[model samples]
Target: MHKTKISVDNIVDNQTFIPNYPIKMSIRDVDFFYGSQQALYNIHLDIIENQVTALIGPSGCGKSTFLRTLNRMNDTIPGTSLTGTIQLEGVDIYNDFSDTSMLRTKIGMVFQKSNPFPKSIFENVAYGLKVNGIKDKAIIAEAVEETLQKAYLWDEVKDKLDKSAFLLSGGQQQRLCIARALAIQPEVILMDEPASALDPISTSKIEDLIAELKKNYTIIIVTHNMQQAARVSDTTAFFYEGVIIETGDTKKIFTKPIKQKTEDYITGRFG
Candidate 1:
């Protein structure tokens, strides 16, 4: 087994690093279960505000499961239970006083598949704002434009805002979904394999967007692509069989992993 050194700063490249942001979220001794089977171990991690943290591992390694716990997305699954502390800005998210719906508004999610509702492009992005009772049309329109531009989809679909979102290509649709998420102005965005279904060009575009997005929103992504994690994230955490083997800066995790298992997984020796 090849042993790799683990260091935290290797995850984010200094050239693209942002400065002076606070710690946005923290996960301490997190454990999860689906019915009677536990899916995650005693996981502890910190998500820096305005930076990207990538969760990388092979299939069924609990990366996705861990992502869902951050925003309480796991509550939807029947018989699912979580026992741990997930904090947002020093407040415990799992506490009884923590409102799940309000928590979700602060932490948005983008899925692997583009899941636009059966509505026009304009309506899709406006849904969240409307649900929150923002009745000013001008404000809504301005926000829609700003978010669309941020997602790099404004120029492509600017002329047909009334068109059905399903009419767009897979990549465009995915960007629209991102725009929808951005419309809510969530402080943190959890993405599970956001680029897994796209072509090389689309994947590259998403990666670039993620790099840019870290300046505004803290990001946590679950990805199987080691190269993608290394390229886009400030921090990288490796998972194996429901355990976090090692986590640190992306460079060290890729070039000098602290554990033999992490090195093997990253170097293609074995998953």
Candidate 2:
């Protein structure tokens, strides 16, 4: 796996590389279950502010499950329960926060497959803003344009704002979804394999957008692409069997992992 150098300076010691940023989200002793089956156990992770943290693991390893927990998306599923604290900016998401819609506004999500509503391109981006009760047409229009620009898609679709979102290509559709997520001005973005369904060019575009977006948003991504993880993330967490085996600077984790499983998985010895 190729390792990208991190922009932040870290004080490296024999044991760990200490990141400089404050923790945006803190997960301590987190456990998740679905219908009596435990999917995660004793999970602890610190997501740094304005950084990209990648979660990589094999299939059914609970990385996506853990992602959904951040925004309480799992609460929609029956027989699902989560124990332990997940705090965003020092506020316990489960205990202290009662407004799910508000919490989700601060933390937005993009899925593996691009899901665009059967609406016009402009409406798709403006949906969240409208739902949030922004009634001023000029304000909503500017926000939509700004969000599309942030998603690196304004120039492509500017002439066709009234067009159906389904008329766009697969890559354009995915970026439209991203623009939709960004419309709410979320502080953190959760992406579950955002580029997995796209071609190489589109995937590269997504990676580049991620690097730029981290300047303003804390990003957490669950991806099976090890190289993509190494390339885009400042920190990397290797999850095995629903547990994080090791997590640290992306460079260290890819070059010299502390765990045998991490090393083996990164080296493609096994999943």
Candidate 3:
């Protein structure tokens, strides 16, 4: 495992390996509303490049809502609005970036449930490249193999490229969706409880794949499993009632949380 010294801006000098990578996404004063209901409140978070940042809390605490705001995924819902700025590479996504398609390509998403397209394994991975206007068959084919290898799914499904994606096991389907996301060569990957439905062995595989992926792609994951967050993330944020209670290094957040609320929640107390 490699470690980067913590940046002076983070103010956590106690941790040995708090990432000093540049901020990949900067979210500030973000509030999200669905019609008359408010889901997130004045949220501020910085996602480090090439590191995993986990959003962990009980259900309906705005963890997923905050994750969607990173790539403007929440804009799809009707009667929803957001206030405040979310910047990717210093450009405000909500106010300045109008091209959602290109934004999505740079920041891809994987949902809690595996949502593989109704196509063959090869086509599933090739779909994004084709949609983005890559017409050359050789190029798409090469990209598919490289992406599947990145998602750690190539060797397992290499010989069955023609098989329908639905024929795969649940874990394989999730990995396939991840491969599909990677096929576009996104800069950041947002995962909403990606391994929540998997068995322990499958969950371990996903965790390992995440570890490997963070070497190049910045990752922001929303997970309810504290143990999973502790195991995979470089940083962790605890949300409660739509507000972030604590955010910092994963080890400190789990072992010596500065806030009592964070400690109580992680200790299996009332959420």
The candidate scoring highest on lDDT is 2
Higher-scoring candidate on lDDT, 2 or 3? 2
- Using Cα atoms with residue i matched to residue i, what is each candidate's TM-score against the true structure? 0.91, 0.94, 0.93
Ranking by lDDT: 2, 3, 1
Candidate 2: TM-score?
A: 0.94
Candidate 1 lDDT over residue span 1-271, tens digit each = 1133234333322322435647789887777899978888777787888889999988998999999999999998999998878899998988943578888889999999999999999999999899888999999999999999999999999999999999999988888998999998999999999999999999999999999998889999999888899999988889887777887778878888777888899999876
lDDT of each: 0.86, 0.90, 0.88
- Off-target runs (Cα >4 Å) in candidate 2 are 1-19
After TM-score superposition, the amount by which residue 234's alpha carbon in candidate 1 deviates from its true location, in angstroms, is: 0.9
Model 3 residue 247 distance off true place after TM-score fit, in angstroms: 0.4
User: Per TM-score, what order, best first?
Assistant: 2, 3, 1
What is candidate 2's CA lDDT for residue 13?
22
Between prediction 1 and prediction 2, the one with superior lDDT is 2
Q: Evaluate residue 117 in candidate 3 and report its C-alpha lDDT on the 0 to 100 scale.
A: 93
Which tens-of-lDDT digit does each residue in 1-271 have in candidate 3? 0022223243322333454568888887777888978888777778888889999988889999889888888889999999888999899998887888889999999999999999999999999999998999999999999999998899999999999999999999999999999999999999999999999999999999999999989999999888899999998888887887778889889999977888999998975
> Which candidate should be chosen as best, given TM-score against the real structure?
2
Tens digits of per-residue lDDT, candidate 2, 1-271, equal 1122212122122213474669899987787889878888777888999999999999888899999999999999999999889999999999988989999999999999999999999999999999999999999999999999999999999999999999999999999999999999999999999999999999999999999999999999999999999999989887877777778888998999877888899999987
Q: What lDDT score is found at residue 10 in candidate 1?
A: 34
